[model samples]
Target: MSIPSFLKLVEIQTKVASVIPFLLGTAYTLYRFNSFDLKNFILMFISLIAFDMAVTATNNFYDYKNAKKTYGYNYEIHNVIVRSNLKEKTVLGVIFTLVLVAVICGFILFLNTNVFVLILGGISFVVGLTYSAGPIPISRTPLGETFSGIFMGFVIVFISVYIHIYDENIVKLIYNNGILDISIDIIEIIYIFLISLPAVNGIANIMLANNICDIEDDIENRRYTLPIHIGKENALKLFKVLYYAIYIDLIILVIIKILPIYSLFVLLTIMPVINNIQEFNKKQTKKDTFVLAVKNFVIINIVHVISLGIGAFS
Candidate 1:
């Protein structure tokens, strides 16, 4: 592929969306331990990139096929389908094969047949494929948002942490280091909670927004997404609940000292979240607001990683 074609095929925006979570997990792992095996880190990074690309390709292929069956080869769906000229079956098969190979290589090079690593990797692979391609794609169900959040939030975070910190030596280090003993436990729990909060909220909000935009289309397609199931006003209320709950959770974590007081620096992310909420409240189109929500989520994750690094290492 030509440079421009290759870039378009991979879809830089989609790649960034995939990379943000991995980056957050990596940064958190490095912060907690203050060190990483460079070779393993590089391998994991490559595997993540490959995983993202394969999933993107697979989702686009499946969505395109579904859209074509319903909409009759419309250009609107064509534009959204990556590598649109390729046959859907061929694209799906190729991407799935590539992802399986990548996972195998990842396990061999970085994970060494560890059970936790295998389980996490298997879950990720299954979720990524079944998300859009299964007989009952999770994206089409009422539980779509919940699944997205958990996969992106706790599962990904836990996998990244496990890969980086689960070696015998690291376990021994954490056990022996008196200062880290209490802090590590607290941080791990808090991190899991906080990470899930934004992930769940952000993903739910995104799906809600998309459903709102495509309500007519989605209904016609027989997809019962959250917005369609809950209605618009109720969905907005759900968004508010999700939004406020995240902040409330953060505050509680801070009070309990599960999260470092310094990690309050993540409060800076609240500004964008507030702005997005206000826009949503004003009944603004969610398409206009989606970028803001994503920005806020990314900033919060970055700030959390930074604060954890500073508090743990300093």
Candidate 2:
């Protein structure tokens, strides 16, 4: 597999969906907890990128095997496998190798932290695999946005933050006499969730945009996603509404003072984000406007990350 084909197969362009939130968690950890675990962060980033690549690779492999010859499925712009004619064996080998590396890194994180890390990592691992493989892939259902938003967006941030603070007792697990008890810091979890909404909505919007643009093709392909079930018009409406929610979450964080006032600078991206949404609304074509979703994700999250980083310094 060539470098370009490997990048396309892994959807390297979309990795920002994960990268931004991870940085947000890091920034917040710095701001709130005055903590940074470089070793854990490096391990997690390696594991994360590896696992993310594996997920996309497996998904592409799945589509390459099952996709019908529609809008360039087999010829021009279909799965990278067809576009690049990468060997099937090589794809599978790469997927397993990435997954193995990710698992090893995750296990080391567990050793460094606690078993709770393993639990969280395990859930993400299961979801990633179920996303495109097995019967009833999550991507084929209307719940794709929920899974992608929460896990990729929220959960990644949650784990990233927790990795730095595990010793601070966000999770209390006790085992005695074959019985176990657990206590969680609800307030912290809620705070993290609010901080995470910007990324959650941003990432969710990416999938929403894709589903909206592909609604007709999705129907023919039997994907039955949110855009298909609710109809493209409604899906697009949801798409616009979700972008606004990203800012709302940011403003709310400021109001609650969970995030510093400096973070409100991220709100300035609203107009451009809205403009992108409008253009997408005007034309939801994959080739013509799909890049808008990518633009929105990067712009919104990048501004958010920078603002939070500024707050960290402030």
lDDT of each: 0.64, 0.88
Give lDDT tens digits, candidate 1, residues 20-79.
566666666665555566666666667777877777666666666665334532224333
TM-score of each model, paired residue for residue: 0.80, 0.97
C-alpha positional error of residue 69 in candidate 2 after TM-score superposition, expressed in Å? 3.0
What is candidate 2's lDDT per residue for 86-150, written digit by digit as tens?
Answer: 99999999999999999999999999999899999999999999999999999989999999999
Clashes of 1: 0
After superposition, the stretches of candidate 1 with alpha carbons farther than 4 Å from their true spots are 1-10, 68-78, 82-90, 168-191, 281-287
Error of 2 at 224 (Å): 0.7
Stretches of candidate 2 off by over 4 Å are: 70-75
Q: Which consecutive 10 residues in model 1 have the weakest lDDT in total?
A: 168-177
Q: Report each candidate's C-alpha RMSD, comma-separated, in the order given.
A: 5.8, 1.2
Task: Superpose all Cα atoms of candidate 2 onto the true structure and report the RMSD in Å to 1 decimal.
Answer: 1.2
Clashing pairs in 2: none
Best by TM-score: 2
